[model samples]
Target: MSNSQQQYPFYFKSTIILFGISLVCYALFVLSDILAPIAFSLVIAILLNPMVTKLQKRGVNKIVAISLAIGLAFLIVAGIIYFITNQIVNFGDNLPQLKLKFNENLANVQQWLNTHLNITIAKQQKLANEALNSSQALLGRTVGGALGILSLIFLIPIYVFLLLYYKTLIINFFHEVFAEENSAKVSEVLGATKAAIQSYMVGLLLEALVVAVLNSVALMIIGLDYAILIGVIGALLNMLPYIGGIIAIALPVILASVTKDGYSTQLAVVISYIVIQFVDNNFLVPFLVSSRVKINAFFSVLVVLLGGALWGISGMFLSIPFVAILKIIFDRLPEMKPWGKLLGDEVPTRHKGEIWQRKRLRQEASNPEKEKSL
Candidate 1:
């Protein structure tokens, strides 16, 4: 009967609602393998929507515009695959020489260890042999694997096409679902979400191009083998945020150690990667992606890890935009604005009046001598 007892019931109900939502999210993540292609398709649809709109405005039929957009996307994907396959084949052709270089480098490392450390040559050789055996097993399982390749060959394009075709319907459905009361708020959130995603994809693509070119040039200048392959792979991986940088760095260093015949070359490769990552993090990412997502470093890393765990690499690649979409939704909801603040980089200040007053006073303080001069 008491007010406090009534409040307790409300709090308990809210907790139950939150718990249900969390459970739903967990289930979705567990089913992510099936969902990943669909998620990627949605992302592609958002990216292509502007082009579709532009074509429509130019007197193209809606269906025709959608078809043209999808065709262009397919061509882009095909071209990338062709280029990557060619680079891979070229690398494969040079494998024999690369293997010889690797053995020579291993022998040199063993000799260096024998001279400097107290470990015996026989013990080092045993360890090397064990490592080789483990690596062979791994390659047999990974390269001989059929599941991943089949998914890429069959599933991806099918999903992408369906997504493009249904894009308008999906958007309209969401708009209608939320238009019961605050249609304007729903529209604003949807618009912001689309803009954020589009901006992110565009910026990320440009960043990758820049990184690929820089990495290729650096590796070529250093006279390392498979520089193009390393550069291109590095750039693509770099699209995944935090974890991608390390992978990009490691690939070059590993390849250099195995192909170039010296620790000095390996060291150089490492240094080059560090420099590239430095430029990318400090300059490229901030300039390109920071404004669009507007989430802080902590949430970025958290979402990426969660995404990786949920959908593997595909999830990681899509996580930021996913979170950005969620943030937009949360920001528009009165009770969920706190959740949005938690997801965002800048905490929304409730004391805006005080903040502005302080800023104005600081400006006045800086110009006191000017005021006196006037």
Candidate 2:
């Protein structure tokens, strides 16, 4: 076959592959309510597997080991929920006074704006009231979906338990998908994936703990109320990547402005968060999360945005691990190796000087008589 004829099939195959990916993405978006918990549970299941294996090696039964793993996971989650709930309740008790203080601050802001910008306080108040109403309506709609939240809370653990229980079968299914000759490669990939994901989970938890402690201590020193609660909430939200940090900074700073003495305290809170974010993005992530995931910053942000668009917050949280797993798969297959390179963090240094090198060699090859004379 001629070169063009041979290339036609390659182009057709590429188009088909692209179409397939698009279809899969659409299906995932449509089925997010079902898939989100399953995806989350899969990550938890992977994290818990090593513990289960250790228990089994110590003479524990598989069922007992699985139960212990699930129990530990549930307890950890429950403790966090209880602590946050208690803090929220305590904060609620002071809500009325906080509301009055907030109104005073708003009036001061409005008066300042009116004086400086010639904007009437009445107009500002009208806009504020409209915004408040819209926020309340949004909150009402969110609260109306409590059942879905409850279902996810209930189903996630159950899914984790079942997934852990049947992990061997899942592994077997994965192996069977490939040819017999590729079994060793398949096993290697599976092992690498487990190790990477487990390390990522552990690192993420440690990072959260470190961040929460730092934030709480900083806020406490600055005399911010509910320092621990705000710190912990911010730390947890920070797990969601770019968007989370902005929300984290806004939450405590807004509260500090109302509760604290002056704008100085609010500025301190903002500065503290900036420092925390700097430490996190520069140090903690590189040392902890990045070592495990190895995803480029560009692809990481893109995946998070796409996830949020398709499945909201849960998707954003899960997207990194999901893409990491995909990268692992792509790396193992020769046909997908280019994709693996694209997803990786490192730029290809070898390719930087390749074009000039090829041109020089091609010119030399065409000038054989001149080279011989020299």
Candidate 3:
């Protein structure tokens, strides 16, 4: 019998792999509430690990060290929350005037439509009412989302504490799970994954802070209302990768359209945000977060959208880290190194099916170190 017929067929293996992936995606959506918090906690825990280790080396008890690290992280998060909510309170105080401005703008827009399109005033009023209702509904949803996020915040610290406390247990569990010869590989994967997640999260926070400052200054100079709040939000959203950047750009533009009188103000907002994004993409990301994870643009967008689809906002945030961990594991295994390369951004040789390129590919496949160097 031919090898294809005598052994498990490639199609059969492919089918199983496809099924496994679908099952995983479905499970992610189903168990998001349980998994998302844990995933987030793991990232925070990894970032805090070095501090905890330092304290441990200085003769602090593990629990004490972990607690101190978690406490510091909590304070940082709480400070950010306070900063945002303080702005939100100020925004609430201005609601009456903001609403008045919105109504005047809406009426002027309705009038313009009536004059330009020969639309009746009554029909325009109906459309305005519908829009107002939709806006209210959107506001309600936003409030709900905020509450959900606050709940997640409460759960995350507990998870981080537990993860940090059980750090050795987890390592021992891995050692027990993997075969004896693979112990070194397991440690390597763990160390690399921790470093990657830690760097990515810290770098992301630094990038966001810088971007927020720039955005706030630009918007303030443009004399936009609630400029600080909008700028901070845009910077935070920019952390979410592809889907987020669109939302970030759209939000400031929309705010400018409603509050600022002239089209020029809105145009300025657009131009400023575009320039800031240019700086962020070209300089800030490369300097800060890009090196650690290094997933290609295609997979970054794909996983982000998939994450949003499966686990909502938490999924979107967690996807890149999760992919990085996967790539680390894949790279550590000989059979899976190709899959790791698939997720990565590195493109050493571009042309397809060229003789030299094919030779390089074969060499890299045979020698994983060469592939990494390339």
Question: Per-residue alpha-carbon lDDT of model 2 for 132-235, expressed as tens digits?
Answer: 97656433322225544864668788888899889999999989999989999999889888888887778888889999999899999989999999999999
The lDDT for every candidate, in the order shown, is 0.81, 0.85, 0.85
* TM-scores for every candidate against the unseen true structure: 0.77, 0.85, 0.83
Q: Sort by TM-score, best first: what order?
A: 2, 3, 1
Looking at model 2, which ten-residue stretch has the lowest summed lDDT? 137-146
- TM-score comparison, 2 vs 3, better candidate: 2
lDDT for model 3, on a 0 to 1 scale? 0.85
Which regions of candidate 3 fall more than 4 Å away from where they truly are?
A: 1-6, 103-153, 356-374
lDDT of 3 by residue, 269-370 (tens): 889989999999999999988446689999999998777777666777888999999999898788998899999999967654587788987877899986
Tens digits of per-residue lDDT for model 1 on 1-374?
Answer: 88766555788989999999899779876565566666777788888888888998999997788879888988998998899999999999988988888788778878899899977889987997998976564333222335445546676666766766776687788778865776677678778988899888889999999999999999998998888888999999898777788878888887877865548888888888889889998999888764455787799889888776666667778889999999888887889988888888886546768899999999889999987988
**Backbone collisions counted per model:** 0, 0, 0
Top model number, TM-score: 2
Q: By the lDDT metric, which is better: model 2 or model 3?
A: 2
